[model samples]
Target: MNRPLYALLIAAAMLSGCVTINIYFPAAAAEKAADRIIDEVWQLKKEQGAKPEGNQP
Candidate 1:
């Protein structure tokens, strides 16, 4: 009803109209990342429970 209220409503409406959203889905990248993680885990397992520079078991 007031001038300030009307101006505020107009500004809000203009701002709401300027919204943009972007979504990305990278399946190939995700598969590559998973492969790298698996490789690291296997390497760690192989190095566990073994002497750093000795062959004694």
Candidate 2:
């Protein structure tokens, strides 16, 4: 029926106004993360030739 079609059109129009999209990129945060990863890799290399601390067999 035309009544249902009109109702569907009105509902579609109402919902169309609610569309929103947002995107964000944090460069400082990404740089900090990369630095931490690099530090961990270096620490592992430094400790590779060192003995483990604490009780061990």
Candidate 3:
């Protein structure tokens, strides 16, 4: 019983060491999203017949 418990503890420790976590950020995708938002805002402005702020028409 003692031997089995020790083996199990060792195995658990080894498995814990093998765990990994990863995070990813895609800059290009973020830039594309920003561009889409700007385009939509421009379209909304056009539909409302209002010039965007700070722009000469």
How displaced is residue 56 in candidate 3, in Å? 36
Q: Candidate 1's C-alpha lDDT?
A: 0.61
TM-score of decoy 2 = 0.35
Candidate 1, residue 29: the lDDT equals: 60
Where in model 3 is the C-alpha error above 4 Å?
A: 1-22, 44-57
List candidate 1 stretches off by more than 4 Å. 1-22, 44-57
Candidate 2 per-residue C-alpha lDDT over 27-57 given as tens digits, one digit per residue, 9 for 90 to 100: 6567656656876987644344343334344
Find the 10 residues in a row with the least total lDDT in model 1: 47-56
Measured by TM-score, how close is model 3 to the native structure?
0.35
lDDT of 1 by residue, 1-57 (tens): 599999999998877766532235566567656655875986545344432433434
> Which candidate achieves the best lDDT against the true structure?
3
